[model samples]
Target: MQEFAFELALCAHLERPDRVVGRQLGAAVHGRRVADVCLVEPGPEFDRRAAVTPHTIPPLAIESDAGPGTARPVAEAFDCHPDRARAVAERAVELGFFEREREGASTAVRQTVRYPEQWFDSLVGIENKPDLDRPGDLRDQLRIDASLGLFDEVVLATETYVTGAHLNRLPDAVGVWRFDPETGEREVVREPEPLATDGPGIELLDREPGRAEVRPVTAAEKRRQRRRIAERAYGKGWRTYELPDCERCAPSDAEPADLADARLPWCAWTDGLVRPVADCGPTCPGYEPVDGGDSDGDAEGVPPSEGPEAVRARRSAWEPDPAGVDRRQAGLDRFL
Candidate 1:
């Protein structure tokens, strides 16, 4: 099976029980590679409460000769004003929520933001390798993950048959799993050893072969890094698959629970989850036409094209809302 298929099945399985799954995430920590699949547990009740309530203090506005901007109270661009916004900004500065910057003429400003930190309980990283025989840098990458100790747990999810030799090469702390993409079956070969997130960590450096250097990370730094990583994961979930704009394949017709897990909309007509792309459309055997009003028809004046490049161009027009809902009705047509 292809790695994409394996990753998709894994994502479907992970989405169960309300775990958030993100794929191909840009590494939040510097010097780390992009994670193949990242699973983050929901944050605590405190974090959820904080997310719903806005900051009591309003952001400070910075008016300049060029234009208007907002700055943290500590920023050089931050000129004190006797307003409520200033009071809140000033308090935030005192609380160490803002990092100050002073530029030559225009003071560069930065905002130290806080996320729903309590909402994220743990981060689990998975490396998908469909063919272990063609392993390239797999061992090194897992080792780096182990040494860096960024994720609470790291595991290798592969379709390849596990052997004693393969296990011997990988770090004992890292977990191993046998995955079957077709059946969505997963078997755990080794349970991962939980890494210490509350304490200081060691950042690994690929300085020399067999002689990796390490840097000490303070607990405060780790906390900040964890938040950054979790925020990215929240924005980029594993539901990267796009829905085909077919009249017969209206998302509302699909089972919401099944779609949430599979990332593929279920077609009751087909009695299964149809491919999000090519397998959908009027020409398909299971296609059942609906009102063209909701379909991406030529009523919008844009002709459809089937080439890969054209498909990519079309996909770019759609964007996922923060809540992961597909708001197809957004953009130019809304104006009409």
Candidate 2:
């Protein structure tokens, strides 16, 4: 597939990505699904990446080395369509810069969302989603953002309370956007919000004809999708995913194996919580566990091996909460 200029900018914003949520408000300037807007945690890294190589640069850089103080200049030098380039600038003003990280092997979209929102402020691109233009049964855009491999579900609502005030604009629309698990298409329905209130930006009194169509999930469908979503918790939760590895896929210029012969699951590379322990080589600072134990359970007991059963284990090797290992403010500035 061809790459979007936003690809790099997106990478910059989602370097060590965790979760992403996008909502569609209007037509995307690029004639693509406008997620309307997206947000990345640790939003600073994304900013640095985009600043280094803003996609708006003309004559786009060809993997060349950047000269000194050249970050801003690159963005100014792109030779492309004025409207297209202008769209980048406009988005910068409307949606603040993103924070991404250096690229790694394997992956296209770190992750994708319900719809890439259209930030152009013009309704010209506001046609129904390709998968959502149906009259009305049920429809939802169920996609797994491939970024950090943590966020997995986006519940599509015809109009929802998205970050930038979605559902604020829209009238005479008659149908709810839903996902049909069996057929996997957006559906339209004639019901309003399940609760007694009008959701977020929707006004209760303005129940005009065809104004409030909602395709709520049936109890059975809800259960099935819910289970499906739950099983896919990694892209949506703290669980990690297994990375495929094979002979050619493995490193070619790799170092010989250690006598210990222990390797953490590749998923540990991005798993937020128990990550430190995964890199537990003698040379790594995270090499030693907080308490030198097998489980983060208690202060006493020779627990089972965390990674190696033959190796001795102790209760002292774990942090009180395994999740605290990657904490941003544990104040281990100079020391772990």
Q: 36-66, model 1: which lDDT tens digit per residue?
A: 9988776564344233222221223212111
Supply candidate 1's per-residue lDDT for 16. Answer: 44
Tens digits of lDDT, candidate 2, 84-105: 5444433332222221112243
Task: Estimate TM-scores for all models.
Answer: 0.59, 0.19
Clash tally, candidates in order: 4, 56
Question: How displaced is residue 19 in candidate 2, in Å?
Answer: 8.3
Give the residue spans of candidate 2 off by over 4 A.
Answer: 1-32, 36-39, 43-68, 71-76, 82-152, 157-336
- Cα displacement (angstroms), candidate 2, residue 129, comes to 13
lDDT leader: 1
